[model samples]
Target: MAKPLKCDVCSEPATVHLTQIINNQIHKIDLCESCAEQKGITDPSGYSLADLLVKPESQSAPEVAALSCPECGCTQREFKKTGRLGCGACYETFASVVNPALLNMHKGDSHKGKVPQRALERATFIDRLGTLEDGLKEAISSERYEDAARMRDEIIELKKAMEAAALED
Candidate 1:
């Protein structure tokens, strides 16, 4: 009784559905037969997710070399010649020029590195330590010496535990 899904790219009646879960978020993509085939959905070996994700730019504009990053003053021509950017902001400024090369070189645009379990645990401990320190300051300002003492003791214990973990690693 439900209506069929439409293609995400072409708005046609979708025949193919792909769901991707990244960073605990669900991303759904619906593609019609023609669009799916054109995008190489049928052949896993030849599949290029970048082709579907990055829209083609207009070829009419030939003045891309004139483009420059507002933050670092790096020009497209300079990037093309040096193969590097002046600063972090140049990435966004020259994305149109850089994305195609990135797809060809890395086969993907994003980094998919795995975080170490210990690193995750350490990060959580650091965050909790910061929160406890903030709470201790608040308790002291509010004239609650007992609560402050308890938080201070907890903070010392957490620091010792974190140090022990680091030593174990």
Candidate 2:
């Protein structure tokens, strides 16, 4: 078996492998999915190795080109080319594309920065409280009075637990 080729640009495991014979000479190019898409080699034109290997997920070139950040007017095509965002709003506007890239780059979507234990606990408590409150409202609206009462009790318990935790700190 032959050794797998890496992408010419990013060195990622090449999914798109192209071979061309010119002037009685054989030449080959290897490209990973992202680099192939970045180079516009994934266009479904004629025959290309990328077309056979990399399938686009949802958005086509036209749709991606059409996407633009409303705040800074940064086009998705520009973002793909530059790999930079124009503004904070671009993160939200281009989340679908950006999120996967972020995961690839950071290995996680959210920042897991070092936080004080108390702060982490507080944040978790707040998040749980908000979720319970929303569920409580939904239960009430749907006339699930029992569920609502249970959630309400849960919320009170959560508040008491948080209070005890704070007192300990």
Candidate 3:
């Protein structure tokens, strides 16, 4: 027969196991469910990861109250409390307040990262084809047949390149 795991706190049979790494060191804890709840580790109403990430301690209540999205009427205070934006327009409305936090979280303001090498050619061709198609539509609407024809040819070439890349995959 195997021995039951002992709880670290009270020597009771443990029902929960937790592992954490702090300062490059691994730490393990064994706890009964009740002890885990008492420590806030298993609490349903405890502070969530979103709350911790979005709610900066530097901002005051008055500042939060004054900031709101013009389109959706979602206040910064509401976002802080709920850790979510009301709509996509809220991003533009609250860009000044959120940009710094976003930059910090993503380590960059714009995406200048690398894509998978295998799909690079196909992805580039598809993006260019989309752009060309949009230009072709604009040209046709403006009654510029020459420009529209050029854009259509470019789009066809890009589609051919995409197909070739797909076959090579």
The lDDT for every candidate, in the order shown, is 0.74, 0.72, 0.68
RMSD of 1: 9.0
Q: At residue 15, what lDDT does model 2 achieve?
A: 98
What residue runs in model 2 are displaced by over 4 Å at the alpha carbon?
1-61, 116-169
RMSD in angstroms, all models? Answer: 9.0, 13.8, 12.7
lDDT comparison, 2 vs 3, better candidate? 2
Residue 63 displacement (Å), model 1 = 1.9
Off by over 4 Å in 1: 1-60, 70-74, 103-120, 140-146
* lDDT by residue (tens digit), candidate 2, 1-169: 9988777656789998777554575446677999877767756664433232222434466666577999999976666555467999988877766665455434577767899989988999999999999999999999999999999999999999999998998
lDDT per residue for candidate 1 within 8-76, as digits (tens), equals 677799998876554575545678999898777888685443345444434315566467899989876
Off-target runs (Cα >4 Å) in candidate 3 are 1-45, 53-63, 110-120, 123-163
Superposed Cα deviation of residue 101, candidate 3 (Å): 2.4
What are the per-residue Cα lDDT tens digits for candidate 3 across 1-169? 9988776656788897776554575445666888667566766775432343343535545665477787889977678677678987777766765665455344555557788886776677778888888899999999999999988888887788777877887
Best by TM-score: 1
